[model samples]
Target: MKLQIDRIINEEKIEIDEVIDFSNVSMPVKIVEPVKIHLNFENLGKREVRVSGEILATLRLTCVVCLEEFDEKLKIEVDETYIPETFIENRKEERPIEELSEFTYKGSYLDTFEIVRDNILEFIPPYPKCPKCASKTEEI
Candidate 1:
């Protein structure tokens, strides 16, 4: 989702709670439901912002052992700081090492869809197992 920096700068903070559609996007796994996001964005001054939130979604995954399709619920927590693109150029030489790890926004907006998508992808289990198989393995 794309958020306007101007709004956060003007209001100092904003809260968002909505469902994001990703039907058109390409993903490694099937997303069976809309992504639900609940976030708070706070301006940290000097073109820096803090984003904190939770993302919820259901994904369709195939069990590695049984080869059956099953739904998996994902809950991802987000806590990130964002710096303006101009901040990098202005302080390229003086930028601290820690600052390099922070996320950057271009121009007047922050598009977090990619970040969210990546988080979702990372949350997937590499070797997924259906509930039945998972329980059986646990007893072994």
Candidate 2:
């Protein structure tokens, strides 16, 4: 996941049309494809930038019933908005991101590795199950 941040990108928008490999990366959750991101940026009047976007990706999950691994396409439409730590304390009228109509948020711009870690963790499903395969537990 090599994301190129905008040099003058106080505000920027990007569309990702690529596939990401997850097996090689050690993630807390299982993902099977590259997530397509429709992103928006805001300068927030600081050295830090804010990013909001939608994430679209498929995941390989073990059936909750059978405990067998399978592929499940996940279309996670995210609307997360992240800003610096200072902003969060001052911000008001904040609802939990998961409870909101969309997945939105606030965070500081971490270095490349930290950014990737946060993104992957944020979207990774805690318990993944194949909709069609959940009940077919017996070995085939």
Candidate 3:
């Protein structure tokens, strides 16, 4: 989902609520269901935008303990800031370490799909377990 930078700047804030299809994209893990995202894009001056919202999705994962397939529901809260790509070039020398950690966008649009994909990947469990195995472990 690409959003126009100009519109966000003019309106100061934009709210998005939709289900996005990622079947065509190559994802590291299997996303069994469409991703539901409710996001707020707020222009924070100087071409910087703050993206805050929630993402919900179901992922098909393999349980490490039982070696069975299971669906894991994810509800991730997002709070990120994006700066213009050119800002790096302009303030390379003066930019602080923390500022360098923010995401950057180029040209006239902000590609939110990438951001959503990255966050999903980051939130995946390192060791996934099926409900049966999870409950068994808890009982131990």
Candidate 4:
């Protein structure tokens, strides 16, 4: 998912298309979704730039009762930006998940993988349900 942005950074628009890894994520993130994040960077500035477009992926959810994997698709439209000020400064520097906040280009360039990955995660469902399936422990 390493996106080379050298060409896109210098231009008015750059298109990023690729699949990202979710295997290392927590339970739900690992269980559901085939992550593919797409980005189109534009609305450029000397020190700031915008990243926009869609995130598309397929999610397979297992029913609680039947325990069968069900198929679902996800597509999320994105509109976000990055500034040089907020980008990662050092690879060795450890950062909190929150400190990882703020969209910015690293090494004077945008890292497509990081930007797209963050945006896609924002669209992840907090609680996913299987339409035709029921929860094992029914709620009163």
Most TM-score-accurate candidate:
3
Report the error of model 1 at residue 90, Å: 5.6
Ranking by lDDT: 3, 1, 4, 2
Better of 1 and 2 by lDDT: 1
lDDT of 4 at 96: 67
Pairs in clash, predicted candidate 2:
20-34, 80-104, 81-105, 82-106, 82-107, 83-107
TM-score of 1: 0.84
In candidate 4, which residue ranges exceed 4 Å CA deviation? 1-6, 20-28, 31-34, 62-69, 86-102, 133-140
Q: After superposition, how far is residue 68 of candidate 1 from its true place, in Å?
A: 1.3
* TM-score of each predicted structure versus truth: 0.84, 0.54, 0.90, 0.61
In candidate 3, where is summed lDDT lowest over 10 consecutive residues?
Answer: 92-101
Q: Please give, for residues 97-121, the per-residue lDDT of candidate 4 as tens digits.
A: 7544346656645666566566656
Model 3 Cα lDDT, one tens digit per residue, 3-107: 999999999999999888888879878999899999999999998999999999899899999899999999999998898888877874776777644888889
Deviation (Å) of 12 in candidate 3: 0.4
* RMSD, every candidate, angstroms: 2.5, 5.9, 1.8, 6.3
Q: What is the lDDT of every predicted structure here?
A: 0.87, 0.51, 0.90, 0.62
**lDDT assessment of candidate 2:** 0.51
Cα deviation of 127 in candidate 3 (Å)?
Answer: 0.8
